[model samples]
Each structure stands twice: as structure tokens, then as C-alpha cells.
Target: MAEIALCFAAMALRGFGGVLGHSYDILVVRRQWLSEREFAEVYGIGQLVPGGNIINVAAILGDRWAGLAGATAALAGLTLPSTLIAVALLGLASKLAGEPHVASAERAVVAAAAGIVLASGLRTLRTIREAGRPRLVAARAAIAAFACAIACVPFVGLPIAVIVATPLAFLLERRAAR
Candidate 1:
């Protein structure tokens, strides 16, 4: 229990913005707890759930390994430290809200986070290709999904855009698979 908590806590700390992507590294490369395919399987399950993929990942991974106790431990470890840090940062941001540089810094941080997310995705695609899915249809679907999301973000908003694009993307996948 302690070890599971510690590992997930470390994963959260190390992952920051790209938790799922980083999980591939920490779990597969470092811990050897899961192989590349298993990591993909776990992450696919995480995506199937509604809320945050990373949170679902921690819970599912915990449950898979050690049942309820593991789930609790992993969730607590992932949330507690991150929550405390987020609260402290939010408080600080509120105090600094009027400063021009603070706003700029926030944009920069958000931009960096987006870059990390992009890189994580690229890494995942590369992994899938390396794992023998190199036919390029998945890549095309990803590009289409991304383009649709970009267009839809201004039209319908992000959440609805994602909701809409997801099924379209899946359909594209089904087509690609055939």
C-alpha cells in the first residue's frame, strides 16, 4: 500500500501536465510494471471513463494491482499533493492577478502545457507505430480529429467539440481498420 501510494505520488509529481504520457515512461520504462501494450490498454480504459484520464488511470491501476486499498492510496497520493499545490498557487495567483507580467506568465505556462500535451501525443503515436501500427490511418484520423477540434473550439466550444469529434474520430478509426 505504501509503495503503491509512493509510486503514484511520484508519477503525479513527475507528470505535471502530461500524466498519461508520462505514465508510459514511469510505468513502462522505469518501473517495468507494464509493457508498452499493457500501458496502451490501461490508458485506453482510462479514456473510456468520463472524468480526467489521469485520475481514472490511477484508480484503475490501483484497483488492478491491489483492489480498494490500492485505489484509495493511489487517488490520495495523486490528488493530495497536487491539490495542495494548486490551491497555494491559486491563492498566489489571486494576489498577483493585477500584475501584467503575472497574466503573461500564466499564458506562457498554459502554452507550455499545450506543447507538452502535443509532444505526449506524438510520443504515443510513435509508440503505437513502433508497436507495429504504422499504417498511417491512425495518424490521419488524429490529424482530422485535431483539425475538427480546432474548428469546433470556436464554434461549439471545447467540451462539445471533443464530444462531437470523438465519435467522428472513432468512425474514422473503424473505417481505417477495414
Candidate 2:
């Protein structure tokens, strides 16, 4: 458990811009924790499930390797530092909210985060498409629809729409296959 927590903690502290790619290589290629295909499958499921994809992945892999206790350890390790930083910075952010430089920095960070998310989606889609899965290719429309719903979160609210969209997305894919 400590090893799981420490490994995830190191991964988390490595920063976020290229974290996904780095993590994939480390866990699958280097650490031998998962195979490429298994990673792909888990990454897909993680993205489809609620909450941050990588965070979900940590829990999933941990559970697979060490059961419930491992999952808890991985999750805590992955989230703790960032969570603490966010909490610590919340007050400082509020105080500096009106400053021009702070505002610009915040905007930059937001843009980077959005880009990372968008790129992750695109990369996942491309990976799936390139995997020669005819069924998945035929169901691209369903994926697009789900993406639209996700984008509309600012209007429809989160978690609720995501929960509703998940099964509907699968249904749409089933329909699209016909």
C-alpha cells in the first residue's frame, strides 16, 4: 500500500501537462504494472466513468493489483498533494483574484488545462480508431454525442448529465452499429 501510494504520489508531483503520456509509459512500459492493451482498456473505462480520468485510473489499477485497500492508497497518494495545494492556495487566489497578473496567470492555466483535456480526448479517439476496431469506428457518432454532452456541462450541470449520458452513449453506439 505504501508503495502504491508513493508511486502515485511521485507521478502526481510530476505535473499535469504531459502527465497522461508520461504515466502511460511509466506504468505500462517501464513499471510493467499493465500491458498496452490493458492500459488502453482501463484508460477508456476511466474516461467514461465519473471524475478525473487519471485519478480513476489510479484507483482502478490499484484495485486490480491490490484490491480495495490498494485503491484507497493510490487515490489518496495521487490526490493528496494537489488537493492540499489547492486548499492552501484558495485563499491566496481569492485575495489576488483582482490583480491583473494573477488574472492572466489563472487564465493561462485554465487554457492549458482545457487544451490538455481536449488533446486527451483526441488522442484516445485516435488510438481507438487506429486499433482497427470496426465496431468502435462505426460508433464514433455516439462518442461525439457524449462529447457534446460533456461540453454542455456549463449549462446542464455535471455528474448528473454525465451519469445520464454514459448509458445513453452506449445505447447510441448500439443503435449506430445497425
Candidate 3:
């Protein structure tokens, strides 16, 4: 039980820029607690469920670690700190709304966030390109993924986009093979 709490706390503290990013991957890939395939499966299951994916993943991992009690403990630990921080920030923002320095700080934070997002996207592209595949095939796959994401915006359903693209992606791979 202590071990479970420690594991959950470690993950919760280390996670930043959202859990779906490298944080979850670290738990699976670096720690060897779960295989990559297992991580992907758990992520998929989280997406299928209604609530936040990170919370769902935490719950799943917690349950795996120490059953129901572990899940409850993990969920509380994972959410409480962040929730408190959010509430504090909101209070501060409300108090500082008319201050020029506060507004400037907020804008700076937004710019930094944008920079981080751009860097993350480029890193992901580089990873895909370097994944031992032909450049042309990888490029095509990237384009297809981009198109699918765009289509998903109008459709408003990720599963529908996946359904539509899965066979198309397979066919593209087959064509590239030949």
C-alpha cells in the first residue's frame, strides 16, 4: 500500500504538460511497469470512457497496483494538488484582473505554452520520421493523420475518424510496400 501510494505520487508529481504526453510513456517505457502495447491499450480504454483520460489512466494503474483502495487513493492524490493549484490561480487572477503586470505575465505564459506545443509537435514528427520507416511512407502517413484530424473537427467524433481512416491507412501501407 505504501509502495502504491509512492508510485502514484511520483507519477502525479512528474506529469506535466498533460498525462497523455511523455509522462504516461515514461511510466510504461522507462519504468517498465507496463509494456508499450499495454500503455496504448490502457490509453485507448481511457479514451473510450466518459471522464478525463488522465484520471482514468490513474485509476487503472492504481487498481493494478493495489485494487480498489489503491484506485481511490491514487485518484485523490492525482486530482487534489492540481485542483488546489487551479483554484488558487483562479483566485489570484480574479484579484489581479485589472493589473497590467498580471496581464503581461498571463500573456507571457500563453506565449511559452505556444512555444512548448510547437516544440512537442516537431519532436513527435521527428520521432515518426526516425521510426525505421521509409521517408516517403512516413510523410504520407503524417499527411493522412493530419487530414484525419482535420476531418474529425467537423465530424466531432474521433472513433468515426479512426474507423474511416483505418482501412485507408492499411491500403496506403500496402501500396507503399508494392
The top-ranked prediction according to TM-score is 2
Task: Kindly list the per-residue Cα lDDT of model 3 for residues 1-178, writing each as its tens digit.
Answer: 6555566566666666665675455577667888888888988888667688878987898898889998988788777766787799899789989999989999999999989967865665565454345766565667667655766586565666666666776776677667
lDDT for 72 in candidate 2 is 96
- Report the lDDT tens digits of candidate 2 across residue range 1-178: 9989988887887856545776787788889988899999999999777778899999898999899999999999888987788789898899989999999998999998899878876776665465436766756646566666776768655665566766776675577557
Deviation in Å, model 2, residue 17 alpha carbon: 2.3
For model 3, the local distance difference test gives 0.73
Ranking by TM-score: 2, 1, 3
- Global lDDT scores for all candidate models: 0.78, 0.79, 0.73
Question: Could you tell me which residue pairs clash in candidate 1?
Answer: none
Q: Write the per-residue lDDT of candidate 1 for residues 1-178, one digit (tens) a residue.
A: 9988888888887875557767777789999998989888888988878788889989999999999999999999888887888899899889999999999998999998889878866675555343225555566546555754575557557676566667875765686667
Estimate the TM-score for candidate 3: 0.59
* Model 3, position 88: C-alpha lDDT score: 92
Error (Å) of candidate 1 at residue 175 is 6.8
Clashes of 3: 0
Residue 172 displacement (Å), model 3: 4.4
What is the total number of backbone clashes in candidate 2?
A: 0
lDDT of 3 at 29: 67
